[model samples]
Target: MALLHRAELRPSKLELLAGWLPGRQWFAGEAGAPVSRVAAYRFDDPAGEVGVETLLVRAGDGPVLQVPLTYRGAPLAGADEHLVGVIEHSVLGRRWAYDACGDPVYPPLLAAAVLADAGQAEEYFEVDGKREARPASMTLTGSRTGRPVPTGPVSAGPGDDGVTVVRVGDVELAVVRRPVPADVPAAGGLAGTWPGQDEPVLLAYAR
Candidate 1:
């Protein structure tokens, strides 16, 4: 389960993305366009530490873009290249946000989610000091193949065609930065559906 507080972020997520998105090679939107949040989903960290969230955003008239991020209380060692920005959460205090692709906790979880039948985590928000269920803005389901997946640290590979491949041991997990339908069936991967997109689209795969 993922707990969300009814708190404010000093420099909102969009504020951070505004400056960061333009630097991404996969971003096709016009520079300096206003960014809007479309939807998002989350995956829980079993140890209940880092926050893993994937946001779908749009800029101007550009297509929706996918960005996965990890939030931690402290900076991740040796992840300077992947740091998106620092955020001040009203309730959580200071947070270090990093690109999920470079977060060690993310790869193994991604690999397991794609290979197993794992689903998005349940979300709840604080309202009047009470926790209430907050349904996810987007829904994601993993392809269930019952196949074994790699565990432990996974090194992120260079992006190619809007996809980033990460490897752990001999296994590689491909994550799609731009959501699109796959030409063929997914052997083991993750797919998602949002408000405007009724059909599930391929978002990742184990290759």
Candidate 2:
């Protein structure tokens, strides 16, 4: 389960994304337009050390962008290239955020989710030392692959058709960087939905 805290974050998530998104090669938004977060989902780290989350956001009427982020108490060794910048959390103090694609802890968990046909992790909020169930703003569904989950560092590279390829071992997983029409199928991979959406949107597939 993923536990959320009702606390303030210095610079905030959106603030950080606003400054960082435009510099990304895949961002389709107007450089100066404001960005709005549509929805978000979380995945729990089995070890409970890393916080994983994916955010769906848009600038104007441009395509919805999928950004997976990982939060850690300290800098992840060898992940300087993926750093989104450090920020201070009101409840957790300082945090280091990185693009999930480059985080060593992310790919294996994501592959496991796909192979197990799992959804996003359940969420809870702490209040008065008690945890309360919190509904997720977004939902994810993975397709069973039956293959053993791949391990090792993931190397991300640009793929054909605008997808991002995350290589684990010798297997390459293609991640849809932008939201596509609902009629499109994700095949044997992953799909997601946000509130008010009638159909699951394709997110990624094994390649």
Candidate 3:
């Protein structure tokens, strides 16, 4: 389960993304275009230390983009290159957010989810020191695979179109960074559904 706190965020998530997204090499939006978040999903950190969330966003009428982020209480060691920015949370104090593609904690968790056919983590909110269930904004379904969970840090390789190859341990996972036609199918992969979407959208494939 993913726990959320009712808190104010400095600079806000969208505000930060507006400044960061345009700089990405794969960004298809016009420079400085306003970006809006369409939907999001979260993955549980087994240790409950890091916050892992994936945001689906669009800038103006540009293509939908998938950006996964990891939030940490302190800076992740040797992850300066992946740092998104530092933000202050009204309840959790300061947090350091990084792009999950470069964070060591993300790929292994993703691999475990895909291998286990796990769903997105359920979310809860903290109120008066008590936990209250909240609706999950997104749902994820992973294709079942009998392979053992992948381990070790993830490595990136050349990709075609908007699909990127991320290696986790000995397994190669293909991540779709851009949204494709709804009818497109994957032989074996991770799929997700968000608010207003009737069909499952492919997110990643395990090879």
Candidate 4:
């Protein structure tokens, strides 16, 4: 696939945040909450459609949460709607931003992040690399319980109907075919007692 050109993006990262942050599960702002730029930065991406951002927002109370989100076009089915947002990239112009769990370029990007701690020789990438795509998966080891997470289907391999984990030394990158939703709690209260009750009412991402 052809990559997007960088010359098409805008210069303001804050402007990107202004439209991006509210749609995150970790965001603690009120509905349509006004975000006063606390701090922010962008990530490098080989593919222009994907935009990564680290944002700090002082919402209601406690210190700002450093939210790292990978934005791209469209929402991952069944994900919290907050994960999707349209931002004008300094290079790719207007594009959606969300998690990189399902993106093809993520394997390489992920490899870079993991290799920083695990060493490049120990990093790996997984993809289909064909006309048809299969699901993608990832395993985060720092977590207390080290387990694999199948991120769902990705592009199939060159001539195969399935995907492959291009291994690196002892490290193996397996595409998580199915992602488990984080244990989340439903919103409480009948109606009037809820906070931010007077906003563009929708389901809140509560854990």
Candidate 5:
């Protein structure tokens, strides 16, 4: 289960992405465009430390961009280049945001989603002493190919033509930036349907 808090952020997630999105090699959006959150979903960190969430945002009229993020209590060492930014969370205090592709904790979970059919974590919001289950904003489904989930730390290469290749041991995954049917490498990968979009779109591919 994913536990969330109703808290304020000094620089909200969208604010952090507004500055970081332009620099991506795959970004094809116009300058000074409106960046708004479309929807989001979370994955639980088994260790219960990191906040793993995938954000879908639109910049102007461009295609929805898939921006997976990891929020941490401290800076992720050696990931300075992929660091999105630091923000002060009203409840969690200081939080470091990193591009999920560059974070070590992301690959295994992504592999599970692609090969093992793992779904996004169920969410619950806690306010005061009360806890209430919250529905997910989106529904994600795995390819369910039943292959062994990739292991080992991932080292991501630079984004090229809107896809980032993440290497985990012997498995290589193509993480799509702009989720589209054409980005699906072969047929097995993680696919999802969000609020506005009922048709499934490719999110990542394992090859």
Candidate 6:
């Protein structure tokens, strides 16, 4: 039988978010509400330097806002145990665990994800929320170095009122443009199969 290297769930940053999301003014949940998880997915970087996680959370009475996060294992000065699990990656064969979005290698790792999918090239990065900051538009950026080569012209997808869609190669990521409520069921576990090498949706972002 094939070995199943599943993610060991514990009190993660999700615990912090459980209390924080309901307090935000931009939150779409009801006044004084609750939120929880619905499903999630994990992706391994082709280069084996980082890991990407997308969480599909169903906030109370609101639309599901997809939260994308990156993980790294290099010990950060202040991260310590807050970095979640430090298990050996089945694919990478190295033990790693840390909030990767803030890792110095995040930009290139993310850019690699984009380029590997035959999507856009080096655009830019962003920082927001309390956890791993997010990457905003592709046209804006101050960092200019090519770890992941850009392939072609960037394209847009059908975006909703608060969602932003960007086409990377053949994939479409729907990024959340606005914040929403935080009252909902907790994510029981991550869902969906591993993303193929080239799928139409690299990630569907939310806020």
Off by over 4 Å in 2: 182-187
**Prediction-by-prediction clash tally:** 0, 0, 0, 28, 0, 24
Once fitted onto the true fold, the runs of candidate 6 whose alpha carbons sit more than 4 angstroms away are 1-8, 12-14, 23-26, 30-34, 46-49, 74-101, 112-207
Tens-digit lDDT string for candidate 5 (64-170): 89999999999988999989999999988999999998999888888888777788999999877888999888888787775677777678886567888888877
lDDT of 3 by residue, 83-176 (tens): 8999899989999999887777788877876676776888899888899998877777886767788776677654677776778888787777
Q: Write the per-residue lDDT of candidate 2 for residues 1-207, one digit (tens) a residue.
A: 999999899888888888888888888887767788988888889899999998898866678998889999999998898999888999999999998988877777767666667668889999999999998887787877677777776788677776777878766777777866544334357788877775888777776
Q: By summed lDDT, which 10 consecutive residues of candidate 1 come out lowest?
A: 180-189
Please provide, for model 4 over 25-63, each residue's C-alpha lDDT reduced to its tens digit, 9 standing for 90 to 100. Answer: 444555454454444333466545555543445544433
The candidate with the higher TM-score, 2 or 6, is: 2
* lDDT, candidates in the order shown: 0.85, 0.81, 0.80, 0.37, 0.84, 0.40
Once superposed on the true structure, which residue ranges of model 1 sit more than 4 Å away at CA?
Answer: none
Selected candidate, larger TM-score, 3 vs 5: 5
Candidate 6 lDDT over residue span 105-168, tens digit each: 3333334433333232221222342233223222111122233443344444336665545544
Candidate 2 positional error at 167, Å:
2.0
Give TM per candidate: 0.94, 0.92, 0.91, 0.36, 0.94, 0.40
Ranking by lDDT: 1, 5, 2, 3, 6, 4
Model with the higher lDDT, candidate 4 or 5 = 5
RMSD of each: 1.5, 1.8, 2.0, 15.8, 1.6, 14.3
